[model samples]
Target: MKILFLGQLIGKQSIAFVKEHLASLKAEHQIDCTIAVADAVTGGYGLGKNHAFYLRKLGIDLLLGGEAMLSKRDLVEELAQIHFVLRPANFTGIGNFGYGMRHLHTPKNQQLNIINVMGMMGFHRVHASNPYQLVNKILDNPKHPSPFTLVAFSAIASAEKQTMAHMMAGKCSAIIGYGAKAITLDAQIIDETAYITDVGRISAPFSVAGFTPESEIERYTTQRPRKSEELISDEIELQAVVITLDDETGKATHLQPLRATYPLNVKAPANTSAESTTP
Candidate 1:
C-alpha cells in the first residue's frame, strides 16, 4: 500500500491549495491513501470542525494533530465523533478528547494502524504522558491487530525525534517527525521502517514557516504581544513524504520525499520604495 503523508496545513489558503492539487498529486504517485497533520488547518492555530470535514472531502483519509490540537475549542466535540481525526495519544486526559490511534482498512484491502504521539521535552506547556512508554505499550501488546503501523512523532527537538525513530525502527512501518515546519534531509529506511525527521509544511515557500517574515521578525524583536500571524500568499508549495509498504509483510519498502509548487493565479505584491523626506 502506498500512503501519501503531507506536512502540516497552515491556514485556509493552504487548504485551498491542497484541494486544488491533491487529485493530481495522487494520480501522479498512484497513491492509495492520504494523511496530513491538522494542527494549523483552520486559521493557522488549530483544526476547526468545518475545516476537518472539508479536508476529508478533499480525499485525505486521515488527519493527525499535535500539541496545538485543541487550540480551537470548537473542535473538541467533533474530534470525539470523527473516526478519521486523531490527537496525540499520550496527551493527559486524552479519553475526554479524540483518540490518538486508529486502525483503517485501505482501498487495497490492507489494514493500517496509525499512532500520534507528542514528545515530553521542549513542550513545557503541554501536559502529556511519556510517549516512549505509551508507544511501547501499544506495540508490545499481545494481540496488537495490524502489522502495518505508522507513528507520527511530533517533537521540537531533533535528537528526541531521531531517538524515537531509532527505537521504533524495526517495530513500525514508518515514523514521521513533525511540529517544526521544516523538512529534514535525513529521510531514509531503517530496518524496513521509513523515517523522516520532519515532513515540512504545505504553505508559502518565501516566508518564515508559512507566515510573513516581517510579522515574525517584529514579534521576536519587540518581545511583546503582537497580532495574529499573517500567511504569505505567494509561492505556495506542497511538501510531503510517501511511504510504500509491502502488502504481505507490512514493512516499508520505499520512502520518497515530494515537493510540488502550486501555480498561483495572482501575482506577488511589488516592493514599494520608501519616500525620502523633503530636503
Candidate 2:
C-alpha cells in the first residue's frame, strides 16, 4: 500500500535526510510512499514553487503548500493535485496552514485518511481556537471537495497529558504523546474512548527530548512565580488525534489521545488492525 509520511521542515538541513529516507524505502521495501514537508522552500514555512520543484526532483509524488500562500497560477495548475494541505480544523498560524486528504493516492476520495501534526516548543498555539469548527469547515467546503480521515498531533506536559488522556481517551481515535513535546487528538469521536495504551509512548528516533520532572517544576516556578505557593505536580502531555472514515459504517469517528506516547505494539490503532487482517 502507498503511504505518505508528513513531517516538519527545519530548513535546507533536512534535504539530505529526506532524500535518503525516501530512496532507501523505495529501494529496499518497495514501499510507495511520499514525504510531505510542512515547510521547506518558502519563507512562510509553507511549500513554494522552488520547494515543490526540489521535492519533485527528489521523488516526492506530491509536495504540499500552505493554505495562506495566495495563488500562484503556475503552481495552481501544475501542483494542483497535491497543493494546499488543508488548513487545520482549529489551528491557524499566520504563515502556517493545514492539509487534509480525501484519499492517500487520489484526491476527492473521502475514503482517504489524513494525519495533521503541529509541534510546540513552549507556548505558541499552532492551529485554530475551535478546532472542531475548523474541521467541519474543511469537510463542508464546497470549493475544495473531499472526504477524509483526520488526525492531529501536538506536545504537552505529562500531567496535562494524562488529564487530557483520561478525559479524551475513548473519545479519540488514538491519543499519543511525544514525551514533553505536544499532544494530538482527533477532531471527532467524543466520550468513553479511553484506552490504557497511550501513556509513556515514544517515537522512532527515541531521541525526542522529554522534560525531566524536576525541570518542569522549576519552569513553572520561574514562569508563574505565585503558582508555586500552591500545590504543583510534574507531568508532560503529548497528544495526537485520529479520525477514521469507516466505509462500512459510513461515519467518521474521532478519538482523542490520553498521552503523548502510543503503545509500542500499536503505532496507529485504526489502520494497524486492518493492515493485519488485510493479508
Candidate 3:
C-alpha cells in the first residue's frame, strides 16, 4: 500500500493548498491513503471540528495531533466522535482528549495500525507521560497482528525524536517525527522501518515556519509577550514523504520524499518525485 505522509498544515491557505494538490498527487500516483499532521490546522493552534471534517472530505485519511491537540476547548468535547483524528497517547492530565491509536483496513484489505505519541521535554503547557514507555507497551504487545504499523512521534527536541525512531526502528513499519516545522534530510529505512526527523510544514515558504517573519522577529526581540502567530499565504507548497509497504511483510520497500509547489510557479516544478534512496 502507498501512504502519503504530509507535514503540519497551518491555517486556511494551507488547507486550500491541500485541496488543490491532493487531487494532483492522486493523479500522479496511486495513493491508497493520505496522512497529515494536525498541528495548527485551525487558527494556528489546534484542529477544529469543522476543519477536521473538511480535511477528511479533502481526502486525508488520517489526522494526527501533537501537543496542541487540545488547544481548542470545544473540539476537546467532540474529539471522541472523530474517529479519524488521534491525540497523543502519552498526553496526561485533563487536557488529553481522544484516542491515540487506531486500527484500519486499506482498500486492498491490508491491516494497518497507527499510534501517536508526544515528548515531555519542551512542551511546558502539556503534561504527558514518557513516550518511550508508552510506545514500548503498544508495540511489544499487539492486540491484533497488523501488517503495517505506523507511529507518529511529536517532539520539540531533535534528540528525543531521533531516539524514538531508532528505538522503535524494527518494531513498527514507519516512524514520522514532527513539531520542529523543518524538514530533515535524513529520510531512511532502519531495520525495515521508514523514519524521518521532521516532515516540515505545508505553508508559505517565505515566512518562518508558516508564520510571518516580522511577527516572529518582534516576538523574539521585544520583552512584550508574544501574540498569536500570524500565518502567511503568499506562496504555499507541500512537503511530505511517501512510503510503500510490502503486501505480505508490511515492511517499507520504498521511501521517497515528495515536494510540490502550488499555482504552478515557473521556477519550481509542480511535483518532484524521487526514486527510493533507502535500501
Best by lDDT: 1
Judged by lDDT relative to the true structure, which candidate is superior, 1 or 3?
1
167: Cα error in model 2, Å: 7.6
Could you give candidate 1's per-residue lDDT for residues 166-268 as a string of tens digits?
8989999999999998888899999999999999998887877777777778778987655446466745888899999998898999999988788755433
Best by TM-score: 1
TM-scores of the models, in the given order?
0.92, 0.41, 0.91
- Candidate 2 stretches with Cα past 4 Å from truth are 1-6, 27-35, 40-46, 61-84, 91-102, 106-110, 115-127, 133-148, 154-279
Cα lDDT of model 3 by residue, 14-38, tens digit = 7777776787886577887788997
In model 3, where do residues sit more than 4 Å from their true spots? 228-231, 264-279
Candidate 1 stretches greater than 4 Å from native: 142-144, 265-279
Model 2: per-residue Cα lDDT over 1-279, one tens digit each: 223333343233334334544465445434344434333223323344555566677776544322222233333344435443433333444332224432354332333444333333333324335433443454455343333232333334345334444544443333333322222332333342222222222122222222234444665567633211111112222222222334343243433332332222211111101010000
Give the lDDT of residue 226 in candidate 1: 59
Going through the candidates in the order shown, the clash numbers are 0, 60, 0
